[model samples]
Target chain A: MQAEPEGFDRVLSSMCTEPHPVAREAAERFLATNPGDPGTYPTVAELEDRAITMLGDIAGLDDPSGYVASGGTEANIQAVRIARERARTDGIESPTVVVPESGHFSFRKAADLLDVELILAPTDETHRVELDAVRERVDDATALVVGVAGSTEYGRVDPLGELGEIAHEAGALLHVDAAWGGFVLPFTDHEWTFAQAPVDTMTIDPHKMGQAAIPAGGLLVRDEALLDELAVDTPYLETTSQATLTGTRSGAGVASAVAAMDELWPGGYAAQYDRSQANADWLATRLADLGYDVVDPTLPLVAADVPTPTFEALRDEGWRISRTGTGELRVVCMPHVSRSMLESFVEDLAAVSGRTPTAVPTDD
Target chain B: MQAEPEGFDRVLSSMCTEPHPVAREAAERFLATNPGDPGTYPTVAELEDRAITMLGDIAGLDDPSGYVASGGTEANIQAVRIARERARTDGIESPTVVVPESGHFSFRKAADLLDVELILAPTDETHRVELDAVRERVDDATALVVGVAGSTEYGRVDPLGELGEIAHEAGALLHVDAAWGGFVLPFTDHEWTFAQAPVDTMTIDPHKMGQAAIPAGGLLVRDEALLDELAVDTPYLETTSQATLTGTRSGAGVASAVAAMDELWPGGYAAQYDRSQANADWLATRLADLGYDVVDPTLPLVAADVPTPTFEALRDEGWRISRTGTGELRVVCMPHVSRSMLESFVEDLAAVSGRTPTAVPTDD
Candidate 1:
């Protein structure tokens, strides 16, 4: 049977990409181990710690307290659970979380699961959370104020520092969903990490842009004590308690996260960000020249107002693309997305739209 | 860096075992694909459906509706979420789940996360859930009644048929957590599957006894309508809604599950179960001859009332064993466990207990 597509060739608009060779090897070597039972698999457990330390370094935390989660959804859910539990301890009934309208949909899942009221504060024209709206939503029952760092739709980073201040003022914690942006945001001037804000929790996925294998999502808390809210007593195991959402999880993600971070931390990731950002800019310029409305390429993500017919035609031509909620064609410039691929996609777009292709200047 | 403990040697307590060779290769091949976005990765998505179909066959559900979950914890959590949502629709505000005392700890995590009350029913002398206790605890508030098929502690299968009747009478759904038993129980004379019982949902892990890679837990429902309760709108993706708990999950698990199931279904799993059961029986006899109180080998799991000092001493001797909640030493005879390995473990037990080793007749 045809197991896989031809090596992520026509894949775009996906946060995941091809795993690094080191990460693939690491995942294979540790595939059989279970980090859930740390006592049984001490090797992978150590790797998970190292992966967290590297994530801490990237997210600007001195000491990180978290585990490698299934993905951004699990990480985000755990963050909300922590906030809700803390609020319950404070005798707050019907705890609520104020989140940006541009936040990931996992927040809605968390709200439904944890019985928290989700207050969606509108985002500004730039797609960042409106600080005033967040301030207005905070109340005694508010447990958390969430900010999106590298949002899924527009790749916008909210003003996390200001959001943290507002949340703390209202006696609520701040959580940043940096699932997609955490890897590249360090090279930029975005103040979205623990060092930059009073961020109680953060969801940064290694599988997204960290070049680790799939399922390497990171959830870092400012203090280890914050994890106590999510801990459940684990019986018949060596560990006393488990804070993760899933039990008997694979060690592949942990080992791969460590391997990928070790192979491509500051220098390699910086170079990748530069190339990807340049590709996004190139694609955005090409689309704009074609008279299409485009969102600014904030973090290697381009959303253009391509017509539905043109979009469908391009898709029929074998270009894997998706449309946002607002009907704008979205394209994420992941690591596998090269200049040639973008050029081909633009050519296909021009062909489908019956527009002349523009000669965009290329750095490479 | 010592990546792995020398190939599952001395590891006698964990439910996870080494992945089948075909499963490892399949996982590596689909390491980067995300089954979460089925529209983007159709190849792996098809494999996921095939995996579910195979899981349905094993679980005795002819037309199963389910997804490959991260692990048993996620599957169990999703099942609870479904029950809670359905109960909410039925106007039950404070939903409770009646789980056996021998149930996996994930139920507690599910209770804390899903805002559902957890009611732990006592177990009988054979380690199975007490039917009378379950009947007494289940009321209008009970949304779900959980039965353990191959429990974590003693590998005891609860009376799922009777539990289903009780749950249905109370207007509750019955969920079977067969995460470690689904593969082997198909070969046993246990009335624990969907065909045998009125099981509304089931948690069966391919990573456990299925010999697939980790993070390959299966969640199967009796009907497709049950998944609607867990559905959440997913924007900017090929699919409009997502029922899975985590987003952007790895396709490795799905591919590996299909590969493993295809490689070892009826005949292979039957042979393995026979061998593992024989091994458990052999170990139980050896321990009983040494004057140790042993729980019968109900399902390839042996629990002996070894003294705390002896258990600690055996652990110090590098035997990776664990104690159940009642302080009995527990050993699971997984697929990786062999006759020689059990013999060696018995030898170590005798050495630590200062007793003469008894020669047990071996089938091999």
Candidate 2:
């Protein structure tokens, strides 16, 4: 097949919002120069193998057999679907899905889509899943229990090791929704690890921490046999070896993911993680010293407990802070964030919180 | 936000398999040169208006309103979901969906996912939905009746005019799945016009004939109220103004789709339709003259009835023909299909079909 346009044209594609440049360049290069034998329209099975192998390496899992999906939501939906299907196979009619309150909203959405009953397990004081609360919710009717790695709010890792023990004891499949933290956790907070957990399935999105591109999500299964329940074989596009909700996927995305995986593994991840964490720590210290309450003092992500009117004051100081619901501010110190930018942001935060300057009319 | 990379790097990104070059370039150019603005993220309402305006111009629906989806399957699923929701609104508890066997399998998958009972409406001798059978299947419990425009099998369109009457008389919603043929039919043979039919909803994929890249599927409804039933609002993502299965979409795809519509609309489709028809006709004639059975002799897509042995023999001749079931051959004269290539394929077909060449001696 003719190669898709690269560079500016590649970025403009409506197929995906913002594909990673390096990944896209790799795809274009592959197109310009055939990587393997020409004439074959690479089989879905081969792509699946490459993705599984690459994602497995990233997640610290061995042979993570799974399917590719459009995004985290789709992956979560499919994982839930499989969880329900597996329940049915094990002779349960109506299955309940136990999820933490702080878990990804995708679990609830997936439950809604699957028509399964949702049981929200209470979170601990730290805004992470409480192991005992989750244990109390599991029953013979429970299909799956979802655990969070790094939650969107508070940015604290859940006690998966404790939760996994509870889920396994109850005979329910434990699904780790690591969509946000899956790509970064391996390299962050050395104490945070999944070496002891019996995680049946997990979701990983490269679009977030891996920072490969948009529209990259994976549902990884520890054992291969679990896929048989969700396996769909179609004449046109079979899921015999593919991981997707839809057929006829853009090979360009797949190629980019592979390249992104190559760039992110090992040394690159450790360095990037440390940088983001350092930036987060620096911001937290500065914000706290300015008399603002920094939520989750230990976590890399910090939220400023500020009055609603404070947003205007901050805006005047040229600070681009995000609102974390009512009376709070949220700031993300991603890998791309530099120390100078953090210092500037901190300075602006202080100026905004310290005194009111000359009024600048708000756009609204 | 910084414009994502394009070219070889982009293609390797996880966002998409292929990004439209021109559209990608245009979007990147716009982003690079323009200042940041909130208008960059179009609201759901704005998207609905744009879709309605575009569909009204192309499909000739006076009050066309639509919601975007990632792919054709999602559009079909949403359409089915809405149809069922509408049925419930009309006081039908258990809604039944009647679909032709030739329709895309997404309907069946959606039916399974939505928990709606599926009734396979028997088709006529031509594999089109039999109107009488569909009429018989409709009852007070019937939710929707589906019709396919340009089925993947033979590129044959169902008689939507007749089916529309049956659905209307039975008080069931009529949905036309025009995902494949919507962009082509307006410019193809007007004799098989289903454009004037009473379709409550229709799906069209820009990535196909519109050539806007991938993952651009839309569900256009004559009555916008139907979409309201599927509308969901979340605090994180603003999906209020438009309805979609997703929250954070690749805005890049939307831009490209808009660009593609502008580029391929009006007289552009005329050329594509003409070329495809000519190629189909030419190939069909050549296949029949060479003593091969072709499905839907009058259609643009030819499915050659060749034995497996014959197919494998022809495959050795460098023809990458797709096979359905045991021995059915499907040939599509897509937009990029060149005339000389088709002629060359025909010549090679004649040589391959003349006689099964003896197997050459090999070391194996």
Candidate 3:
């Protein structure tokens, strides 16, 4: 474990964005703090309140109901739990949820754990959910209509405003899975939050684009009062009276996420995304010149159709990357994936593609 | 966030055990490692396997299938989910889970989240679940029978061997939640694991009596092949094809638990617990001499029949403690609860109880 982390150095891991060094310091700062048991440690509770309020402001809610979950998986599962509890209170039976085929895998896990029927809404060529297709799936039994803010495959945000309108029209609650886009799109012109749509719940991860320490995923809901309905009381634990999905959790993640937000929010994060965007644009252009059909990136993530041989070669060269089931290579331009690392990756990619990659202009 | 932790200065927190400083070092070692997306991290995955195997051995498991959950809440929910999945596959509908009244609150949470009917089996005078009451609760619809090895209210082991036999006779799975008891019971002559009972699933927390860093609870099962039935595929993640409830998690908890185990496994932990037991016996005898009826401790946990005035007085003196709903003052004698601290606490209790405590003989 003390081998100096050769695993993550300059690795273009499509599944993750590199966590910043600030996240580590914050995690260490609260290594002894367990925020989950607020009764025992009140200081962590204050930090949790501050973190929630700050995230709520960005998500367009003055006061919000939420929990700092382990990750998107727990957040997504909790969102469904909230929706199901809401539906049950309204006398709905056998409630169902509709999610896009491009949605994160947690929806399926939630569907399985919650005993709810999950129907897939179709996606178009860009991998965005077809708004009309989703509308057709929302019947009287639909408790939630989920729209993916950024698909894991292509980082394409669905038409959340249209989806929200359709869900409201059908009397179904809308939840946005913005696990990847939440941190970045808040800085961009992308309309992906409560300001642009009437979202009942949303999944946001500080571990992803916010570059916070691990396990800092959040589930933010509209109203603060509805939380009483979500709690399952465990008389023994100081944490059981709350609506958290876990019992005793570290304040390390919450502290790190709040610390990252303090550093990144308002204006500092925009510059980080700008650098990632520049890297993605340069990489996409270079790959396109080599005859790869790359989906134009919306964030730092880019997906390109690559030959299986070339995809395998990238792995052999110690460049951490991922591929779709169809062998399309994906690159997440994290801060670690620098210009020099990209140049080295393309050199090996070119050898397998049987073509040379033309260099792109870098003015900045 | 850096408020100099007045919350945990040798305070005997009933809900927590102090994490060793070595645990903090372990967390720092992998602060940058996020093994949730395992494809990017080949090293952490291997370490996770090693840690799981080592924990499984201590739990008397030859080979186990499990996840390093956030804590007991997630692990208990997952165990119930696994039972429900197995029951549904066997054509049982509306699965029912029977738990002892002394069971942890996570069972009630799992019942709510997973849509299972949770039936509370009655406990006896000592707060141990009656074997007959538990036996009568199981039926054809039963998916799981939960037995707490050591109840948080009263640290008493239920007859797990008998409970397991009944569950097996009913063709139901038994999940033992040994979150607090797993670490210490192994050193004691307590029959709490696979060696004593046929448990399908078990919950253990390294952060609890194990004294690792925060959020290191695990759920271990008897068989390895059952994991395939539990996983939801995330095509983009390195761990996409595996079974995990959370998507993005820090590797800090895993590294710390492994490090803690390295420090405390076969013989090292025995010496630590012996000191705690000696401290508990001396304190309990001292309290009983003050005319306070104290429950004999089993695993460094003691419950005393303290008046409201004394309980409030102790709290006013800045000691962190918890009380049973019935007003029994509880003290979990963790490694941090030194002999001097217990001596001082008993002195305060004697003052509040209007009696003088007699000195106890201390012998190795």
Candidate 4:
């Protein structure tokens, strides 16, 4: 296998093909220096407990138990599996899940993977699921109802409190797919919040809004017994002495998550969320002034309904936004984004709209 | 939520409580450096192809293919799901899987997850599955005959060739649980021989022998049609044109695997197998000569059947090793392990056996 060089050379050759050498080198050095048994590395058997405590603190759930998974998809699948088993235990025939039309597609995938029937609640003009529709869809056979804390298209927060109330009334579990908002919601200045929900479980992606490396999403259960129903262990790998859909988690990813949580606490997200919201509001205002129909003008995510030609024109003018199939463009503002990036996007937008001529992007 | 700074003074604070400032800086730098469609920043589409190509390369198959999963456990579940459908298609009354007793326990877990009957077949004294027993277990109700390449405890390679042939002769599919040996066998200097019978599927773990960062494993299928039988997709995240499961994969993990493959192919693992095998062989001979009953003296992995007193004695001599329930010590020789480590292990064994230590561990 050693053509003419050594193992180190082979490693270097692989590194060359990586997207970012500096980042890859940094990642490699980080791995080499911090190689420790994650089970005991970050403090022994308390790894899972630590994750649980962190989720509780973030979601404002006084008592919660977290199960780390590879990503949001697996976490969603595990949540569905637990819900299905709960329905079976409750003597429900043909368990059904009530999910919003705007909910992550993982909802349907989870239902399919677990062989449970999925019932998608219809959305309103703004793409928010209709609370009345969700209430009407729930029945005695309902296993679980999903509420998206942050919809992918517009980053719109759903009516979790209303949905949770409806699902709980039907004797069904209310699960929140908060993969993008868990790290941000705690810092929101709103009042009637997610903390008021009769929610039973939630999914959070540390790799997304939390800004950690990949493979570090989790499913947090308000009722730990629910997770117990899905617990599985094998002889090759030690899982939560109960049940788990996946086994052999990467310790490196676990460490990164722990590291991400430690960094996110203590008002870290307050500043990031505030800046992001401000930028999004500004972008929405600017785009609307340019005659685009903006959704939820005050939100930190701007979705503008524009024709394909307008979108291509903006792209030609150097904007990197995406166009949804329904003639909407989504612009996300993360912490890494700067005011200058927004200004540049706006300048390009203005030019595309024929309202300005060759306005240069500002640095500030 | 920002609290009073700790003793580490916001340095470890940034790393522990918040996301890595370093990775954020890298993402920022990457955004500034490549300021277009952060979509290229590892999009769902790119991840889909990368996963399919990566899994295909591992199983030696082609595309319209597999999906990225959490690990071998998830992969096994997908494989079993497909096999079950295949049985259903053939109208089997009760689909049964014939698995070697020495196979990874995940196979059993997969069967249990899918509600399929499992027939455990005994292996020979060397821990290889007995072909005659496997042949006897296959019937019209058989879905898959599972084989192991290298077992966890004894590191014995099953006669995959004979087992594959028997499964095919019985009109059953052969699934090779080569999670451990997949990366090893393809690169080892040992004879390149396997029974020429068609292998329907295989599971390989890049996290282990492939030396990629964890949470990278795959299920490969020879006939891509099997994936279609189990294929389920969602709009939130795309899989291959056909897939077994669908969701947004950990893009960074998929990127890391691509990097790992680039490091492993064409000669990456070629020399590693040579060094590891040499070390294992040397350790086996030394242990056997010192009056220890080494399991599979001819294989690259050496498991020594020792008394409790012998184990305690070795532990006292400052040797750290794995132990099976049956008082057997197991050692895995991998690429990073130096030969001197093996020599030192041998010397420790000799001393524990009341013999003089001839070799000392090299400090390298």
TM-scores of all models? 0.97, 0.85, 0.95, 0.79
Highest lDDT among the candidates is held by which one? 1
**What's the residue-level lDDT of A63 in candidate 3?**
78
lDDT of 3 by residue, A228-302 (tens): 657877574444477888878778888888888887886767887788888988889988987788989888888
Of models 2 and 4, which has the larger TM-score? 2
Winner on TM-score (1 vs 4)? 1
- For model 4, what share of native contacts is present? 0.19
Tens-place lDDT per residue, model 2, B197-268, is 888888877656556554456678878788886664333221223356554444334445666566667677
Model 3 chain A: which ten-residue window has the lowest total lDDT? A355-364
Error of 1 at B310 (Å): 1.7
* CA lDDT, every model vs. true structure: 0.90, 0.62, 0.79, 0.61
Cα deviation of A65, candidate 4, in Å: 1.9
Model with the higher DockQ, candidate 1 or 3:
1
Q: What digit string (tens of lDDT, one per residue) describes model 2 on residues A1-364?
A: 1112222211110112234466555443332111111122443335546766878876668867886565677777777887888888889989899988876666666765677998998877777788878878999998888888776666767787777777778777888877767666786552333354778888887656665444456778887887766654454321123325554444434555667677667677677778877877777776666666677534446676766566656645544444533336666555545678677666665555553223332211
Write down the C-alpha DockQ for each prediction: 0.72, 0.21, 0.60, 0.20
Any runs in candidate 3 off by more than 4 Å, and if so which?
Answer: A1-4, A14-18, A238-240, A358-364, B358-364
lDDT of 1 by residue, B145-262 (tens): 9999999998989999999999999999999999999999998889999999999999999999999998899999998999999999988887889999998887888899999899
lDDT, candidate 4, B190-260, per-residue tens: 22122233678777766556655445566777776877776553331211233544243444334445555
Runs off by more than 4 Å, candidate 1: A357-364, B1-6, B357-364
The alpha-carbon lDDT assigned to residue A117 of candidate 1 equals 96
